[model samples]
Target chain A: MTPDAEQTGGIIEVRGLKTQFGDFVVHDGLDLTVREGEILGVVGGSGTGKSVLMRAIIGLKRPSAGEVTVFGQNFYEAGGEARLAIERRWGVLFQGGALFSSLTVAQNVMAPIREHLNVEGDLARDIAALKISMVGLAAEAGAKLPSELSGGMRKRAGLARALALDPELVFLDEPTAGLDPIGAARFDDLIVNLKESLGLTVFMVTHDLDTLHAACDRVAVLAEKRVIACGPLDEVRRADHPWIQEYFAGPRGRAALAAKAS
Target chain B: MADSPAYFDIDLDNGVLKLNAGGDWRARFLKAIDSRLRDFADDSVGRDLIIDMSKVEYLDTAGAMVLQRTFHACEQRSAASKFVGANEAQRSLLEQVEHHLAPCFVAPSRPNAFVAMLDRLGAGVSEAYFVAIAILSFIGEILVAIPRVLTRPARVRWTSTFHHMEEAGVDAMPIVGLMSFLIGAVIAFMGAKILQLFNAEILTVQLVGISVLREFGVLLAAILIAGRSGSAFTAQIGSMKIREEIDALRVLGLDPIEVLVLPRVFALVIMLPVLAFMSSMLGIIGGLIVAWTAMDIPPALFVSQFEEAIAMSNFWVGLIKAPFFAFVIAVIGCFQGMEVEGSAESLGQRTTLSVVQSLFLVILIDAFFAMFFLEIDF
Candidate 1:
C-alpha cells in the first residue's frame, strides 16, 4: 500500500518544525506526517537527530518553532489538559524495557491504568495480569519484580505496559538494542502482529536493519538534521545519500536484499 | 690513598642521621653481632667492621633482626658499626624498631604525622562537601516534587506511592526493629557502668528514655533509612533512566516527576514519622532490659520513670525531624539517581553519595533542632 493511501486521516502531522539546543541546531525546518495505521521507521546513525525528531513529535522536548498536530490538535502549542488528553492517546516502548525495579511486572503495567483511568484493586490487578499474558508472559510472572526478569521478558513487560491504555499510537525507541538476534526477530514479529491486529500507528526509532526490513511500512532516513529520504524500502535503498548508500550496502543490508530477492 | 676499600659515609649530628647519596641496590645484608660472632673467631675482634646497607632498600625480618644484634654488639665492643647512606624507606624501617636501639642511633627528621593527617582530612572534607551538595540537590528535587504534586494531582498515582511505601517502610521493619533493640541494649550496658560508679543506677531508666526518645532513636532510624531506602531510590531512578522508562513515561503523556517522584516523596514524608516512632519504642524496650536486670529497678518503676521523662514534646521533636530527614533522603536518592550518567559505575557512585548525603543532612538537621530547642525556653 502507498504511505498515504491507506490512512483514514493523519494521526500526527509536523510542519516546519524547528528545534535547537543553544548553538546546536538539532532539527531545522523538519516536516513529516505519520498517517493512521502505518509503521513509520525512523532510521539514522548515532547523532543524526532521529531520536531528537521522535522527542519533538512526542512533546517530550518542545520545538524551537513549528507546528505538530496530533489528532487535529496543535500539540506543541497545547496547554494543560489539552496536552495530557493528546498524550493519553499514545503509548511508548523505550529501548531496554525500563521496568521499575521496585515494582512487580503487574504493578508496572498497572501504573498507567491507575494514573490515567483511576481503575483500582481487583479490576486493576486483572487488567495488569491480562496485559502481561498478552505479551506472552505467564500469569505468575505478574508478581515478579523487574530485577527477577530476563532481558527479553523485561522488553515484553515494557510493551505490555505501553499497551495498557490500548492507545491508538505507539512510539518505540530502539526496542531491540541489546537483544540477541532471535529475540530481536521475535520482538519485531510482535510489533508487526500488534500493529496488524490492533490497527495502531507506530513511530519507531531504530538502527536495527532487521526491524526496518521486517516491520516498517515506510522508512525515513534522517541525515544532515532532517529527513534525507523517506519512502518504501526499495525506494529508500535506491536513494543517493552517502550514509544511506553505505548503510544499505553493508553486510546486513546485502542479507536483507538477498532475503527480499528470494 | 692507601689500599683501603671505600666505605659509605655515616654522619650523625645533633641526634639526626643524614644520608646524602646512594645508588639503587640489588641486595645488601647488615649482619648482626650474634651471627657474625658465630661465624668469626675471637681473634678477629680487633678488625674494624662496617655495614654497607646503603644498597639495601628492603629489609627482611631476618635482616632487620640481624642489624639489631649487630648494633648491640658494637655497644659492647665500645665501637659502632655505622649504617650510612640509608634511604628514606630504610630509615623508616629502622625507626619502627627504634625502641630496641634507643640512645645508640639517632633518628632522621621524620615527616610530621599531623601534617599528613591534615592533608588527608582536607581531601575527605572536600568529598564530604560534594556529598553534601549532592544531598542538597536531592532535597531540592523533593521541593520540586511538591509543586508538581500540587499542580499535577491527576498524575500523582497514590496506588503506586502506597505500593512503594509498603516496600520501603513495612519490608524494612524487621531490620529496623532489630537494630533498635541492639542499640538499646548497648546504651543500657554503657549507662549501667557509669551509673553504678555514682550509685545513681535508678536514673538509668530516665537516661535511656530521654536519650532514645529525643536523639539517638530518631537519628539512627533516619541514617538506616537513608542507607536502605535512599539507595533504593537512586537505583530505581537510575535503572529507569538507563532503560528509557522515564522517556517512555513522557512519551505516554505522563510526567515522570508527577508519576514517579510525587508519590515517592509523599510516601517517604508520611512513613518516616511512623518509622521513627517505631524505632523510639524499640529503643526504650532495649533500655528497659538494662533497668530490669542491672539497676535492680522493678519493671513497674522503669516504666513510670520512662513515662515521666519522655514527654509529648520530645516525641514531636523527633517525629517532626523524621519527615524532613525522610524528605532529604528520598530526594537525594532520586535526584542522584536521575543525575547518573555513564555506566553502572555512575549508579554505584550516586548510590553511595545518596546515603552519605542523607546521613550528613540528618545530622546537620538534628544539630539545628538541638540549637533551636536550646534557644527556646520550652
Candidate 2:
C-alpha cells in the first residue's frame, strides 16, 4: 500500500508472515493488522505460536517469509536508519517482566529515554520518576533493583520502562499471566488507563479472557498456523472454528463472561 | 488519508482566541509543537482559548500534553479554556491526561563526597568480614560432615563423588601431564645452560631430578587443577545456589555440606596425590629426554645421575604438599560456589574469584612447605 493511501491505515501491518523452527512451522502466511489507538488482544492455545507471532513482528525472530509494516513503512525491507526510525515509535514489555537485574528500577526506565532522547541526567531521572508513579508505584520504588521488588511491582516497572520513550505503540506479552485475580484486574485497568491517557496503540498477547473483555478493543485468535479470527470480543467469540468454539463456550470462558457482566 | 505534518493556526476574534490543530501530532513532531505552543501561550494568556483538534491526522500523548499544558496555563491566567472539534477518542484521551497525568518529581541530591567515601569504606569492610565468617563456618561444617559421611557409608552420595572425580581429576590428566612435562623440559634447559658456564653440565641431571621430585611436579599439577577444576566447581555450585537447589536439599532434611561439599573435597584429596605422582614421573621422563638430546648425556648416565641426586625424602616432600593444595583448591571453589548470590554476574565474579583465591593459597602453602623442607634438609 502507498503512504498516501495509508492515512487511516494500520500502525502495524503483518502480511503473509511465515516462521519456522527447523521442520516445525509456527506461522504460515499469517496476516494481522493493528489499527491506530486500539488495544488488540492476541490469543491462542499453549503451542499455537502466539509469542512467536509477536516476536516476528518485533524483529526478535526473523520470518522465513513476510512483511511487517510499522507507521506505513515496511520494517522488513527498510534499511538500518529507516528501521530504527520505525523502531523508535514502539516499545515492548516482554513476558516475565524482563527488567535489567543489574540496574535499579529508575535506571531501567531511564535507559530508553537516555538512548533515544537528548534529555539531561536530572531531567531523565525526573521522567523516570514520573513514569514509575504513573504506573502507580511509590517514588521509593525507583531506587530498588528488580530483584528487590515483588512480582507485580516488577511487572509495573517493566511497563514503566516500556513507556519510557513515550512510544506511540506498545507490545505486551502475557501482562497478567502470573498475577492473582485482583492483581490481574488491577493490571488490566492500568493498561486501559495508560492506553487512554497516553493515546497508545497496544498489541498484547494474552491468555486471560477477562483482559479481552475488560481492556481489549478487539481480539485476534491464532490457530492452525494463522489468525483464524480477528474482531471485537463478541464477533470473534462467534467464530465457527472448533478451537474458538471450545474456547469461548468453555467453562472458564463462561465464568469470565459472568465476571465481566457483574 | 493524510500524510501531512501536524501544524496549528491561531486566530483571534474579539476576546476569544481559537487554535486549529492539524497533521500527525506524535512524538516525532513533538519538539516543533512544544515551542510553538509555548509561543502561542505567551501571546494568548488571559484570553478565552479554544483548541479545535478535529483536523489532527494523529494525536498521541505528546500532542495531547502540548494542548493540555497550554489549556492549563490559560486557565491559570483566568482565561476560560475548553477543547472543541475533538472526536470521542481524542476527547477521552485529553480528559484522561488532564485528570490523571502524574507530576514529574524532582531529582534527588547526591550525598557529600567525603561522607559517601566513608560509607563505601564501611560497607566494604563489613562485607569482607561477613564473607570471611561465612567461609570459616563452611570449612567447619565440612570438617564436621566428613566424619558423619564416613560413619554412615549408605548416606554417602557415591554417584556424585565419582562424577566429580571424573570431572576434576581424570578429565584433567592429559593437560596436567603435558604441562608438567614442558615445565620439566624448560627447567632442564635452564640448568644445563647455567652449569655448562661453570663446566658442571652433568649437574643438570641432579637439578632436574631434585626439582621435578620436590617442587615443579606437584606445583605444576596443583596450579593446573586450581585453574581448571576450581572454576568449574564455583560455576556449578553458584548456579545451584541461584536456582535454590541448595534450599531444596535442605528442605529434604539433608545437609548441603555432607551431600554436596564433602564428596567433592574427598574426591580432590584422593585424586590430587595420584595426579601429582603421575606428574612427577612425567616430569622426570621429560627431563631425561632433554638431558639425552641436548647435553649428549646417555640414557644410562642420566638415570644413574638422577637416582644418585635425589633421595626418597625428596619425593615425600613434593607428595606431602599435594593433598594440602588439593584441600585448599576444592574448599575455596565450593565455598565461592555456595556464596553466589542472585544474579549471573555474581556467579561469574565468584568463579573468577575462586580460581584466583585457590591459586594464591596453593602457592602460599607451597612456599611454607618449601621453607619447612629446607629447614629439615629434605
Candidate 3:
C-alpha cells in the first residue's frame, strides 16, 4: 500500500508493514490507521509482535516490508533532520517508562525539548517544571531522579516527557504494565484527561483491559501476523475469532467488564 | 496430578518366588519384587531358585545388582536363578561396575567415534565464536566512539566529567602522593649507591630528576588511574547500559555519546596532564629525600642540581603524554562500558578489557613519544 493512500486524517498510517528477525516474522502485511484525536489501543498476547510493530512505526526498528507515514510524511524516506522533525511532532512513552536514571525528573522531561526545540536556560527549566506538574507530579518531585520515584510516578514522569513537545501524536507502550489496579485505573483516567485536553492522537500498546475499555476509542487485536480485528469495543467483542473471544471472555476480561459496569 | 503408582506386583512365599508384571517395565519390576517376597512367605520352597528376568527394559548395573543380590540369597538357600531379560546395554553396565562381574553379565555394541568427534568440534567452534563476538563488541564500541569525537559534540558530558575527576583525582591524591614519594626515595637510594661506586654521589640528583620526569611520573600516574578511575567508569556506564538507561536516552532524543561519553572524555583530557605534572613533582621530591640522606647531599644543593639537570623539554614530554594517556583510558573505559550487554558478566569482561587495552595503548603511545623525542637533539 502506498503512503498517501493510508493517510486519512490519521496521525499515523501503517500499510502492509512486515518486520522480521531472521526466520521469525513479527509483523506480516499488517495495516493500521490511527486517526487524529483518538486513542487507538493495540492489544495482543505476549510475543504476538505488539511491541515490534510499535517500534517499527516509531522508526526504532526498520521493517522488512511496507510503509509507515506519520504526520503525512514518509518516515523511512526522510533524511536525518527531516526524520527528527517528524519524530519531534510525536512523543513515545516506552515500556518501563525508560526514564534517564542519570537525570532528574525535570531534566528527563526537558531533554526532548532541549534537543529538538531551541528553548534555552531558565525558560527550558520552567517549561520542564510545568510539564512535570501537569503530569500530576509535584514541583518537589521534579528534583528527584527516576530511581527515587515509584513505578506509577515514573510512568507519569515519562508521560510528562512525552508531552513536553506538545506533540499532536503520542505513542505509549504498555503504559500500565506494572501498576496496581487502582494505579492503572488512575493512569487510565489521566490518559483520558490528557487526550481530551491536548486533542492528542494516541497509539498505545497495552495489556490492561480496563484501560482499553475506558480510554481507547478503537481496540485493535493483533493475531495471525496482522490486525485481525479492529473497531469500537462492542464490535471487537463480537469478533468470531477464538483468540479474541477467549481473550475478552476470560477472567481478566470479565473483571474489567465488571469494573466498567460498576 | 494425583501421586499414584502404576505397576505389577510380585509375591514370595517361604523360599518360593512368584512374579507379576505391572503396567510398564519399571513398574512391573517393582511389582515383581513384591510378588516374590509374598511367595517366599507363603511357600516353604528353597530361597535358591532360578527366576526369569527377560521382560525388563533398559536395565543398568543397579538393576543387575538387585537381581545379583537375589541370586546370592538363593544360592545361600541351595537354589540358583538366571536373569533372562538382560539386554546388551545392561550386561555392559554390569561388566563396567566390576571386571570380576563381567563373567556374570552380557555385552552391548559401541557407537561410532566420528559422529562424537564431529559433535565436539561443532560445540568448540560455537564457544569460540561467542568469545570472538565479545571481543568484536569491544572493538565495535571503540569504532562507535571515534565517530562521536566529531559528529555528536553534545555527548561530551562535562558535568559527569567534573564529578568523575573529583573522585579520580582529588580522592586519589593521598595514595598517589604517598606512592610517588616512596618511589622517589627508592630511586634516590639506588642512584646514590651507583654514584658512590663511581665517587660521583652528587649526580644522584640528575639521575632522580631525569628518570622521574622522563618516564616514571606519567607512566605511574596512568597505571594508577587505569586501575582506579578507568575501571570505575566502565562499571558505572556498563551497569547503566545493562539497566536500559542508555536506551532511554535515545528514545528521549538525547544522544548518549554527547550526553554521557563526551563529558568523560573531556574531563580525562583535562585532568590527566595536571595529574601527570603533580606525579612528576612528587616523584622527584621522593628521590631528593633519599639522595640527601643516603648520599650526604645537602637538601639545598640537591634541589639546585636537580632543577639544573631537568630541562623544560623533560617536563614537557611527560606532561604532553598525560592528556593522550588520559584520552586512551577514558575512551577505552567508556567504549568498553558501552559495549556491555545484558549482565554483570559482560560488565566484568569489558572492565578487564578496558584496563588492558588502555594500558597497552598508553604504553605503546608512550614508546612512540619516547622514540620521537630520542630522535631530536634536545
Candidate 4:
C-alpha cells in the first residue's frame, strides 16, 4: 500500500501509520496518499478511526509509529519556521466548526490571513468578506457570533475560515454530518466548486455517502485498522470486502448513487 | 520550495496602461503584488488597463483575489480594464473570485454613548424585576409542594436530601468550626485589650458570649455557605440545564423544582440551624480558651461569667436566622441555575451571580433581623 501511495504528485503521504490511545490501538499499518488538486474522501464504519488518520496527518495526534510527509517534509521532524511554513499552506475544518465563540464570523475568517500575511487592512477585510460570500453566506452573517448561527451556517463559516489564507490543501472533518439533506448537498457543491476554483487538494473524513458521490475524486475505506480499499469511488466500490460491500451496495448507499445519477 | 518573488511593471502606452505581472503569485507573495497593483489602479484612471499575466509562473486564490479587487477599484475610479494572458487555472481563479464578489460590507455602527447607557439601565432594571418575580414564584412552588410531600411522607427524596445535607453541612463542619473558633478568640482578645483601659477586663467574657451567640456565629456560617454550597448548587443545576437534563425531567412529567430544587432547599433548611448552634458553642469555647490563657481566668470561672452574660434569647435569636438564610441561599442558587441558557459561559455567569446574590441577600436579611430584635429588645 505504501509503494502504491508513494507515487508522484502526492501532496500528503502516510506510511506505516499506527495510532493508539493508552492500551487501545486505533489504527495499525495504515497507508494513504492524497494527490495534488484532488478531493480524497476517507470513509469507514464508526470506531474504525477515519478521523485518527486525518489527525495523524495534520499533526494533532502523535502516531505511535509512522512518518507523515506533507509537501515531502516529514511533519513530526520539522521545526520552527519549517513547521509554520507547512502550516501556512493548509487549513483544517473541525467537526464542530470550532469557531472562536468570542469572535464574529468575519473576524474568524480574517484571523488566519492576518496571522500569516502582511496586507492592507481594508483589503484583508474585503478578502474575508469575499470568502464568506463565496461560501454562500449573507453579508450580514459576517457580524454574527458562531453560537448565533445554525449548525449548517456554522459549518459554512468554518469553511470560509479554512479558505481565508488560500491554502493549497484543506482538511474537513465530518463537514456534512449534522446538515439537512439540502444543506449537505449544497455544501457538497460548495466544496467541489471551491476545489475547482481554488485547485485545493482536500482530505475529508465523512460519514455522508452523498458527499462521497458528489465531491470526492477518490475514496479510501478504513477497516480492521487499515485502509481496506483505496481508489476512485467506482473502483473502490468494486472491492470484494464486507464493509465496502455493505457500504456502496447498501440501501442508503444505493440511494446516494441514484441521487448522483439524477 | 522557494517562491520566486512576484513583481509588476507598469507603463501607460497610447491611453492603454499595460501592467506586466510576473513570478510566483502565491498567498505569501501577494502583499507586494497588491500594493503595486494599487499604485497601478491610480495611474490607469479613465484609461483602458490591460493586466498581462503571461509572465506569471504561479498563481493562487490569494493572488487572484488581490487582482480581482484591483479590477473592482479600477472600475470604481471609472477605468475600463481587461485581464489577459492568464492560463486556464489562473483565469478560472480570477473569474470565480470576480463572480462571487461579496455585497458591499458596511461595518456595524456603534451605539451612541447616552443611548447605550440608557439601554443598560433599562436592561438592568427589568432584569432585577424579573429576578424578584422568579424568586417569589419558585418559593411559592416549593411552599405548595412542601405540604403535598409532607402529607405523603414517602414522597420526599431522602437520599438526595441527605446527600445535600452531607455536602453542605457535614462536609463543612471543620471550616465552620475553625472559623467560629478563631472569630470568637479574636473578639475576646480585642474585648480584653479595650476593657483593660476601664479596669473592666472581666467584661471580656460577657462581650464574647453575647456577640458570638447573637450575631457572628450565624453571620459567618451563612456567608461561608453562601460562597461555597450556594455556588456549587448553581454550577450543578446550571450544567444540568445546559445538558438538557432539566428538560428531560420535565419531559418525564416531573417538576424540575420538585426534583432538583426541593431536596437542596430542605437539606439547607434542616442543617443550617444545627450548624449555627454548634458554631455558637465552638465560638464560646474559643472565647473561654482565650480568656483562660490570656487573662488567668479558669475555664470554670469563664463558664460562670458566660452563664450570667448570655441569655437563652441570644442563642434563639442566632439559631432563628439560620433557617431563613439557608432558604434564601438555596432558593437563589437553584433559581439562578434554572435560568441557565445554551452555553457554558451562561452556566459560569449564573454560578457567579448565584453566589453574589446569596451573600448579598443573606446579609440584607440579617440587617432586618437585627433591627427587629433591637425593637423587641430580646
Candidate 5:
C-alpha cells in the first residue's frame, strides 16, 4: 500500500523450526518469513501454538531445532553483545500487557529507552509520552500503575512501551482480544495508521478476524505444527485446507468480512 | 563520522525558509537531528516554511517528529507551512507526529508538608483504632468458633495440627535448649559475682533455679516462637488472601476461621507449654554447669539446692503463661494475614506488622502476668 512495502525484503526468516515443552511437541518443521514493512497476521485455533510461534520467533523461546534469522543474521548464533542490538530493533506486546507492576505507566514505557539508549532522561520521558499518546492512552494514565488500569487501558500502555524504542518490527499477542468492539476497531485503525507512518513490520498473533481484514496486509494460518498457508487474506481464504475453509467461511468470519466490505 | 548520513540544511526561499532533509531518518539516527531542530524551536524564522523530505531515504516516526519540529519556530508565528516533494509514507508519519506533540511531564504534586504530616497522623490514629476493633472482633469470632469446634472433635484438622506442631514445637527443641542454657549460665555467673562479696556465692544455685523456672524459660520460648512462626503465619495467610483462597473457602460454605485459624491456635497452645517445660529443664542444667564450674558445686548438691529454691509454684507460674502467649500470637498473626488487601507491598507490610505486634503484645502480657503472680504471692 506504500512505497516502503514496495521495496519488500525478508526481515525475519524461520526454517524447519522445532519447538517442544517436555514431552509434548508444539511446532515441528515450521517455516515462515516476515517481509519488511508489512503486517503479517498469524491466525490459528486455541492451543495450535500461535503464541508459541511468536515466542519462538522473538527468541524468548529457543527452538529445539532449525534456524531462525532476523535482519539476515542468525540471532541464535549472535552472542549477547550482537543480540542486544537486534533485541533493540523489535518490540513485543505480551498477551497480558506484562507491564512492570511497581513502575508507573510512563516509567514502564521509558524503561527500554533508558536501558538501551543514551538519550537524556527528560527527552526519553517526552518520547514515552508521545508514544503513550500515539497508542491512544489518556495523559492521566501515565502516572497510574498497571493494576490501577483496566485490561484495555493496560494493553494500550503496553503498546506504548512496545513502541517506545520506535522499533521497526513489532510483535503483538492478541492486541484486540480484551478490548470492546469500539476499542478494538480503534486499535485496528491505530495499527494501520502506525504501519503507514512507521513502515513497521508487524508480526501479530490474533484471533480477531476484523483485525486481519482491517490492519493485516497478509495472513499466515498456523496449524498441525506448521504454517499451513501464508499469503494475502483472499488467497489464503481460498486455500483448499479444511481449517482455513472453516475459519474464513464460518458465520463470524462472514460477519467480519461483511463489515469490512461495507 | 566521516560521512554526513542524516542531516538537514536551512535556506531562505522567497521569505519562506526551505529545509533540505536527507539520509535514513530512522529512530536510531534521530538524536542528532532532534538536537539540531531545537536550535530552530527558539529561533524566529520570519516567514512561511517548507520541509523538503524528497531526498529522505527512510522516515520513521521519530524522524518525522524531528523534521516537522525544524520549522515549528515559523509555524508558531502564524507563518503558513507545508511539506514539499514528500512521499506518502513521510507525510503520514509527519502528520502523526504533529498530532502528538510531546506533552510536558508533570510529576504528581505532593501535599503541603504540614498537611501531609497531619494526614499521616490522622491515618495512624484511625489505623490504630481499626486494628483494635479488628483484633477484638477476631477474638470474638474465635471464641464463637471454639464452642462449635469443641462440640465436634472431628472438626479439628488433625493433619494440619500435627504439621504445625512439628513446625512450632518438636523441631524447636534444640534452639530452646541452647537459649535457656546460655541464660542459665549467665544468671549463675552474675549471682556468684554479687553474692561472693557477702560470702554467699552458694546462693547462685537458688538464683538460677528460681529465675529460670519462674520467668526466663517461658519468656524466651514465647519470644523466639513469636518471631519465627508469627511472621510465617501472616505471610502464608496474606498470600492466600491475595489469591482469593480465603474468599473461595467462604464461597464453598466453609468458615475460614475453622479451616485456617483454629488448627494453628490449637497446635501452638498445646506445644508452647511443652516447650516451656523443656526450656526450664535446660535452663536449670545450664545454671548447674556454671555453678559446678565456677563455684565447684557438685551435680548432686546443685540438684538438692535447686529443689529447695524453686517451688512447684514457680514452674507453674511460668507454664501457666505459655498457652495464653501462644493463643495471642496465633490469633494476631492470622488476623493480620486476613487483613491483607491485594498488593505484594500490603502482604509484606502485614507480615512485618504481625511479627512486631505479636512481640510487643507478648511482652506486654508477660508484664501483666508478672504483676498478677506477685499480687497472689505465688
Candidate 6:
C-alpha cells in the first residue's frame, strides 16, 4: 500500500477489541482512538490488562477479535511488508526497561535504527548518542550496559531506544514505575518535553496519578475490561464510575491534584 | 500539484528551482535519497531554491539531517533557498533537530580480530589468576574456621550438614551404584577376554578387584558428584548472590562461609567416602557375577582368588583420595558460585564453569595422587 497522503486524523484507532486467555477475559469490546501528536495516558487497577492493551496495539499480542488500525491501515490485517512499515513508524518501551542485558546503552538505541535504516555505523552511533542526551542521559551513559545503570537510568536508556527510529508514535508501559517521586517527576518532564519536541503521539500505560496529572494530554481509565472514561483530566476527573471516584478522590489522588495545582 | 510516482520531483523554470520531496522519507530510503540529493545539489547551483515538504507523509531524523545538509549546501553555493509547506508536527520535529544538533563523539573503531583474540587471551589469564587466588583465600578461611568450629562443636551447623549429606549422599546412591556396577562388569568382561587368550581366565576377578578398589570406584563417584552436586551448589549460591541474599547475610553480621560453605563442604567430605565404599562393594558384587557367569568361575573360587590377589592397601589408597577430591570439588564449586555477577547469564555461566572446573580438578588431583602413591609403593 502507498503512504496515506490524505491521513490527517487519529494516529491509532482501536474498535471492538476482545482479548481473552482460557476462561479469563482481559478486554471486552474495548475501543479507543489516539489523536495525532497527543500524549494519551492509560490508567487501570492491577490486572486490568493495561499492558495487554498496549501489547495488542503494538502487535506483540493478537487480540481475540478486533479492528485495530494505525494511520488508516488495518493493523491486524496488513501484509508483512505493510506491517513492518507500520511497525517501523512506532516504538515501544516495555515495562521492565527491556533493554537487552548484553548490549551497551548506545548499542541498544542503535538496534532499531540499524534494523530500519541504511545509515553507516558512524552515523548510527552519532544518532544514538543524540537520542541518549535527548532523554536527559549523559553521553557517558551510552557506553555502559543496562545492568550497570540504576533503575531510572535504565528507563532513560529504554526511552532513548524507543526514540531511536524517530518514530511518529511511542508506546510506554509504566515508564515511571519503580522510581522515586522526584525521579518519576523528572521523567514525566522528559516525556512532555520529548513529545513536544519530537511530535510523538505517546500511548502510555501508568498507575501514577502524578504522571497523568503532570504529563498526559488525555487520561483513559480502564475498568471492567474496557475504558470507562476518557477525556481531558478535568472531564475524566468528574467520571461517575466507582473506580474513577475512588481513584481520583482518594488521598493519593487528592495529593496529586494539589501537587499539580501548585 | 498532484501525487507523483517518484520520491522527489523537481520543476525548474528559468533561474527558479522548485524541489518537491515527499513519501516515507525514513532511513530505508537513505541510499536512494543520497543520489537524489546529489542531483539536487548540482542542479541548484546559482539557482533560487524552494523545497516543498508538506506532502511528505513521514520525515525521520535521517531525512531532516539530509535536508539540513542540502539547505547548508545551497547557502554555500550563494543561492537563496527557503523551506515551505511543513505542517505543525513536521515543523516541530525540524525545530527539534535544529535546536538539539550538538557535536557528539564517534564510537571508537573496534580492534582487529587478532588483537581481539590476544585481548581475550590476556583477560583469560588474569581471570584464571584471580580465580586461583580467590580459591586459595577461601580454602584458608575454611581451614582457619574449622579448628574453631571443631573445638566448639555445638556451634557447627549440624542440621544443615546432615541435610546436605542427605542431598549429596543418600540421594545420589541409585546413579552412583548403577554407574559403578556397569563399569565393574565392563572391566571384568574385558579382563576375562584377554586372560582367556593366555588360559588365565580366573585372573579377571583379581583385575576387577584391584581396579575397582584402587581407582575406578572413587574416581567415578567423585566425577558424578562434581556433575551433580557441584552444579547445584553453584546455582543455589549464584541465585542468592543475584537476589542480594548473600549481602543480606553479610549485613546481618553472619559469615556466609560458616553458614553456607562449611555445611556443604563438610557434607561432601563425609558422604563421598561412604559413597565410594558402597560403590566398591557393589563393584565387587558386579565383578563376582560376571566372573561366575562368563568364565565358569564360581562365586566361591572367585572370592578366594580375589582375597588372595587384592590387598586391603588397595582399598586404603582409593579411600584416602576421596576426602581430598571432595574438598577440591566442593571448594571450586562454591568459589565459582561466589564469583557470580548481577545477571542471570552470569549465574548460568558460573554454574557450567563450576561443574567443568570441579571435574577437571578432581581428575588432575587423582592423577597426582596416583603418581605419589606409586612412588611410595602403596
In terms of TM-score, which candidate is strongest?
4
Report the lDDT tens digits of candidate 2 across residue range A155-247: 999998998777889999999999999899999999998987777899999999999999999889998898888888998888788998899
Q: Tens digits of per-residue lDDT for model 6 on A146-232?
A: 888899999998998998888889999999999999999999999999888777899999999999999999988898998888788
Per-model TM-score versus the true fold = 0.44, 0.84, 0.45, 0.92, 0.84, 0.82
B313-351, model 3: which lDDT tens digit per residue? Answer: 888888888988987788788878888997566799889
What pairs collide in candidate 4?
none
Poorest lDDT segment (10 consecutive residues) of candidate 5 chain B: B100-109
Report the lDDT of model 6 for residue B105.
39
Winner by lDDT: 4
For model 3, the superposed segments whose C-alpha errors exceed 4 Å read A1-7, B1-378
Sort every candidate by lDDT, greatest first.
4, 5, 6, 2, 3, 1
Q: Could you give candidate 3's per-residue lDDT for residues A55-146 as a string of tens digits?
A: 99889899999998888888889999999889877889998788887788878877886777555544456456556755777667777867
Predicted structure 6: clash tally: 0
Best DockQ among the predictions, by candidate number = 4
Q: Write the per-residue lDDT of candidate 2 for residues B121-240, one digit (tens) a residue.
A: 999999989978887888888888888879989988899899988988999999999988888888889999999999998998889888989988999889999999988989998999
lDDT of 2 at A233: 90
For TM-score, candidate 1 versus 3, the one ahead is 3
**Per-residue accuracy of model 4 over B104-162 as CA lDDT, tens digit each:** 34345569999999999999999999889988998999899999888987888889999
Please write out the lDDT profile of model 4 over residues A25-121, one tens digit for every residue.
9999888888999999999999999888888898999999978899999889999889999998898999989898888898888888888886557
Per DockQ, what order, best first?
A: 4, 5, 6, 2, 3, 1
The alpha-carbon interface RMSD of model 5 comes to: 2.3
Using DockQ as the yardstick, the better of models 2 and 4 is 4
Ordered by TM-score, highest first, the candidates read 4, 5, 2, 6, 3, 1
What is the per-residue lDDT of model 6 for residues B1-378, given as tens digits with 9 covering 90 to 100? 553322777887576677788877665666555766866777666566777897788777666766655665554344447778988867766666654445343333579999999999999999889888888999999998888888999878999999999999999999999999989999999999999999999889889999999999999999999999999999988999999999999999988898889999999999999999989888888898889888889999999988898889999999999999899888888888888998999999999999999999999999999999989998
